[model samples]
Target: MFGPTYVFDDPMTLGPEPSSKIISHAHGITSSASKEEDASQIVIMNLAFNDGKFNGSALSVLGDYPFFQKYKEMAIVGGSGAFRLARGIVTAIIYTYNDTTQNEIIDFHVLVLHY
Candidate 1:
């Protein structure tokens, strides 16, 4: 089971968006041997637009990669709520990796089209 997580950052310094916070939850299903393996994985995530704009969820199919590669991209097939009928592309970049703790800090960029 995946627990709730909070992302706290200063978006003014982040350079991408003007939002201050992004609260989200995600659960992943891995068919590959390991996350570091060059195989595909599935992830379901719910993102909260804390600015009171809207909230949405996404189902993404992620691609494989080498450990040295810090970036990855996924396809969002569909979503709900503010993202109803949403389809988009999502990009993820590894910001920090802790080999000892097997933890990593990643940055995600999402571009969506919806009605």
Candidate 2:
């Protein structure tokens, strides 16, 4: 599925817990991979910040995320507002997941450079 077979708008927080500080929101689309290669998922994401200095800025991230791994790194392609011309790497880690609800909590460590 090249289109948004899996569309999501998940909260961006400082920590992995639900009670973590909400700093932004991540709106993204992930392609549904074939059963044999489902371990690594492709994602295109945009993080829209709404708090503090980063308010109104957005970051575009794209990469292949291997969920089973301890950490997955994604590229910070570009951005708007404060993060304009941004380019960097974001390390993602799965914090928690609920099988019944299909809910997941991920932690991201972003190292970026911008104009």
Candidate 3:
């Protein structure tokens, strides 16, 4: 199944200055994973937005890359004290392929929101 774009109950826009956010990798690494699942691929990009009237924004792309707004999902990591959102226009792509050693690798980013 395809993933949702900008996973949140709030609305979003791709405009100038763009809402700023804090992004982090789940593995704490700024690198990419080199594993593919059953010929199926999963790629995620984490964008954070925090400022103005906006609480925050989160975007996730799975299965494929060059994801459109309709294919992204709003990521909610923690709640309340950790409540946050992700925001950002991703012009990047998600790619997955097997290596010679054959390892199931996965890569994604986590956008941390803050006021």
How displaced is residue 7 in candidate 3, in Å? 22
What ranking of all candidate models by lDDT puts the best one first? 2, 1, 3
Q: Give all TM-scores, in the order shown.
A: 0.60, 0.89, 0.23
Candidate 3 has its poorest 10 consecutive residues by lDDT at: 25-34
lDDT by candidate, in order shown: 0.52, 0.86, 0.32
Tens digit of per-residue lDDT, candidate 2, span 17-109:
788889999999887554554466788999999999999999999998875779899999999999999999989888888999989888888
Candidate 3: regions farther than 4 A off: 1-13, 16-30, 37-50, 55-74, 79-115
Model 3 Cα RMSD, Å?
A: 12.0
Predicted structure 2: lDDT: 0.86
Q: Tens-digit lDDT track for model 1 on 1-115?
A: 1222233322211333335344454444333334443543344444434334553444333444234556777776767667777788778787767789976666778888887
Q: TM-score of predicted model 3?
A: 0.23
Candidate 1 vs candidate 2, lDDT winner: 2
> Clash number for every model?
0, 0, 13
- Give the better candidate number (2 or 3) by TM-score: 2
State which candidate has the highest lDDT.
2
